[model samples]
Target: MSIQSFKFSLQTLRKEGGISQLSYGIRVFIALCGAMALSWGINQIDMVIPLFLGIIASALAETEDGWQGRVRALLITLVLFIITAFGVRLLMPYPWVFGISIALVAFCLSMCGALGRRYGVMAQATLILAVYTMIGLNQATHEMPIWYEPVLLSFGALWYGILSVIWAALFAHVTLRQALTSLYIEIGLYLKLKSKFFPLPTRGAVDSLRLDLAQQHGQVVVALNRVREILVSRIDSNPTNPRLGRYIRFYFIAQGIHERASSSHYNYSDLAETFFHSDILFRLQRQLSEAGTSCRKIGEAIHGGHAIDLRDSEETVAGVLRSIDYLEREAEPTQWRLFRSLRQLTDNVIALQQELDKARQLEDISLSDASQQIPQPRVTFRSILSQIADQLTPKSQVFRHAVRMSLALSCGYAIIQNMNLSVGYWVMLTTLFVCLPTFGSTRKRLYERIAGTVIGLVAAWALITLFPVEVIQLVIAVTAGVVFFLSRNNRYVLATAAITLMVVCCFNQVSDGYDVIWPRLIDTLIGSIISWLAVFFILPDWSHRQLPMTFAEGLRRSADYLRELMRFYQEDNVSEQVYRHSRRRAYNADALLTSTLVSMQQEPGHFRRDTELWQRLVIRSHTLFNYIAAFSAHRGTLIEQPSNQLLADAGNYIVESLQEVAQCLEQKQLVTDSSAEFERLRNTLEDCPSDDDERHYFVQSQLQSLLGQLEEIRRLTLELQVQVHGEHIKDVK
Candidate 1:
């Protein structure tokens, strides 16, 4: 192959493997420099080895994302560490004295995870590394004392942490850019699909939320309000920065799409009327053209007085082109059904664009006030559990996905480990392979493992030839830097490869780095195969099924927690306490929702449960939670009792229906129809005569609305089961 062809093929291979191999050469150069500095710094007689605490510091201080920030990351990391650590630790027994000491350390960490948030996650990971790494490294015949190991490990961790902070702050732009691009792509996809029918076997009849039929329009106002906030700030950022512009425009389009789609979800056959016609399509085209042009002009304005030349921002240009493409596609004779919805979407986009301008000005004026507006608190325990239920990022389900490949990962890992070929890469590759949120995780794990291994070999060959083995110190420094970069992403594959490359290089350097490349490359291939087998066979992640169960659990738990909270509120002289279990409940609830959203993309089958009836329920639950929180916040000035019978009735209905839903799910009899008497009561309950006359005297004034709500929900429960499960409801006679 030509040198240019070889290089091009190698680059493509690395990217396909998700290895970021192109970054290796640069890293090696930096490492060589760092080695020179570090060697000199250490060579000075009696000099104290500099503690590289940057990684630790960065991990600690990172993320302005609130609560779920460091804490969640830390928890997952710790869990991963324990799994690995325990696997090896069982090979030998520690002295009782050391065991006791470790137990104390473990206890302290268990308490920290309970504290929750960024701290919990970060601390758990650190402590796990601290504990397990200490044990693992000690297997060396000339082991350092436990105390010394912790100290040294801390220094190492700290150094890496600093690198992480620097990497995340500076180069995290790459990931952010990709995310922005994805947002746009997702938007375009949503529009295209929504333009068509829902693809149900029965096409003419639509299957949407019964509740949606009641309040679809109610949603547009709320969604537009939220979308406007992110939309304006994003579009108003520096447009000259391509990375920033890409992200901002992506955000604008996604928010606009969401607002547009939500209007459809809420309104009846709004899709048929808005999308299935031609005049509306033309109208939509005119509106979007105006809006897109205005947006392009505004973007130019942000590009520092650069006249609106139209070619500066690729992202802006691309967004405009996409808008045009969508419009053109709509103008086609075939997409008439989309015409109606497209026009409504056009109107929302226009309105939201105006709102964006207003929000931008208001944002500046409200900056200080906004800062004080109680940034979202740490995700409660309930939210966290909820996330688990929702299978937000079912990293664990990497097993049980695809059979052919899962067998491959298991067989691969077992064989490579038996062969003793530095199976660390295999372990890591397996981790990555199982993370396909939307794709088949099992297949991805095997595919990525092979791809990464091949890329690593090629990258190593190139980088090793460029830097001599004597530059060992440089290799370490550069590897450290790359590791810093890796921590910026959740996947951490690229950084892991960087660290792996250095270790492999370390083994090579010790052998005078004079070895031919063929043997090492072949070994890497073997290890890669092992990784594929481990993920595909032993621990294949069945991502699709996990999301549904996880989400359902979170919803059930959230409802249970709310019921408990209400019970607590009703008792007089009782202290309003957020108990530990209740806190767990809350954290799980939020976590589940976040996970639900995350996993929805990864596993389609599982996610379908959420998109259907559950969406209506979850969203309504969110409203209930918000209202409850608001009520609790101002408990002192609250009404002596809820005077609104309808409101109280709605609340009761929600509580009861949710309780039944939970039981139905738990019993695995989710399709069971509502009992005949309850069905009659539900019908009677819906028609609240005189908005009060309130057989109302029969209900608790504070809970009358809740009761009414429960009845309506009971009716909905039956309808949804029929809709979602295709279970026939027996005659209510």
Candidate 2:
């Protein structure tokens, strides 16, 4: 049943009109190949049928584009043909034919860019190649010979359109496979990372990782749908995943625990008070010890390049697998493998701790000096500027887009000018990679482009054979009409398909444009190659890094924000509220960067370093927010029993004061600036230790942890602040 449904879905995509550039380009090839063979039998050839088909097919490319894409394509053709007839002739040799042709084509493409990225690129490529052909052949400045020139160009255009249909089919096939592979990669990475972060077989941590992994899978759905957009409707309109709500709802439970922990208002604990105590310490030591042994084995495995054993990837993957001789029982294979991996991960965590300790020791100098400084005034102008730049065009992305467009068009131009190249028609091939999904590499994109082209050619031929020559013109007309209607909805690819069929019908069925097929095929191949080369070699945006770094930055800032928020909740220190905007700003920026990265991935290849950093920033920021949101709502309140009310109030006091002090040190220096509100919270904690109860026990449980986190925050802040100030600060010890 699933297989049948999947097949049905494929059929839907194939039958559907409106696709993107890649599909459109492929269909163009199909229309040419189909019409040429059909024309061999017909005494009379009219291009009207093929032209109409091409438009309809192109319109279907973008499902929602409605009739806009069809109109856009027509407008582009109309405007360019007019300009080539008038503009190219008058300005030739006077200002140089190259400059005029480039400018004219560039202007036309830029105008059509309103449709979408691929459309603009294709228009420019087509315009340049067509004009170059006319110029290179030294055709008359005035009117063309009615018989051959128009017929040939029209037929060539029709063939190019047919190739697009073939391209669409291939794209649909490849993307399905890619989506599945991506899901497995994400699952593996999640399991591996969790094995390192949570060295124990604790139910809580395991469940947490499981939930997060599920969310990751949901996100992959969005990514997959986005890729599928190449052959279907844009995914932006799709519904959000149902599993997302599960994570959010589950977070409430953790949130209660975190809140209970954060509510210690008068916490004045030192390192000994909240530092690593017996139970948690014992757990850590054991895990680290086990992890070290595991790491050694994993290293050996890595060196040997063998698949390690596994139990269940999501379950407990640690401890020695014991074989019971009496019962004849052994650890399951999955369990054994998982344990092996976890063991190796534990070793790495221990190794990482050594580096952490070294960094901690390096911070001995600035801790004391940071106690005496005051805060800096906030910058109003920069904040205002950031808020106001809503409509600002991203210059780097735009410029690179334009330059790449230039390279593709130039390739088309070179073929027309240099070789009178029949391959000049290949300019249509460049359209396939122009706006590839996933910001993938141009090489990979080109491969897809080539595929779509071949398939579209075949599809167009099959359609032509079924319809035959007699009514093909009618079919072309109807396709044109549909392309016109649907392009308004942004279904450019469908429109392109219709347009391809129409062009082929017009050139072959309506007129003998099939005679020009040989030259057109060469043009198709050349254009595809040149465009791919341009995108592959030219200065590319490091997309992967950008999205990741943005995520990471957001995560780091959110952590700081959460700490401040916790301070406010615990000690009534309202000051932490002032820094709230910092995290918000970081999140907003991260979101924008992520959106861009998602869009760029379709472009092709390795992402730039900064882009990767931005992506990391996004991931980290999301992690921090998710972690905090998962942990608390009231910040310092607890779900468990309390030691005493007095202890509770004290914990609250310390949490606030320390958090404020830490936050202040992040931007300035921390002075002994405890407010009346903070003092009140301290008094409250001092008063609360009457008897053991839920509140009292809760306070007792969280007291030490709160203090430790505060000290850690302060340590981090002092180190950063000192670096900002100077290197001569004296040691605190």
List the RMSD of every prediction in angstroms.
12.8, 17.1
For model 2, residues 236-354, the per-residue Cα lDDT tens digits are 11124222222122122112222221121222122113322313223333343333233222222322334433222111212221111211244344333222222222333333333
lDDT score, candidate 1, position 191: 30
lDDT accuracy of residue 377 in candidate 2: 28
Please give, for residues 1-733, the per-residue lDDT of candidate 1 as tens digits: 1223423432343243222223323433343344345645667211112122223322433332212222434345434444434433443244444344443443343334333333444544544354334323432335444344344434444444333334444453433333333333223222333333322114223323323221322232222323333333333222244434333443444344333332321122443444444344344333333333333343323322333332322333345346545756646665543333343344344444443343223212222322222123445778756644443232433112222233443343344445554323233233323323234443444454445545555666566777664455344545554553543233344544554454445434324332424444554456455544444345444433444455456546656555554544344443334432453454346445544543444443643553555545444443333333322221222223444344344445556666666555444454344456455544554454423232222222223333333444444555555665554334332
C-alpha TM-score for every candidate: 0.49, 0.42
lDDT of each: 0.39, 0.39
Best by TM-score: 1
Lowest lDDT sum, 10 consecutive residues, model 2, at 319-328
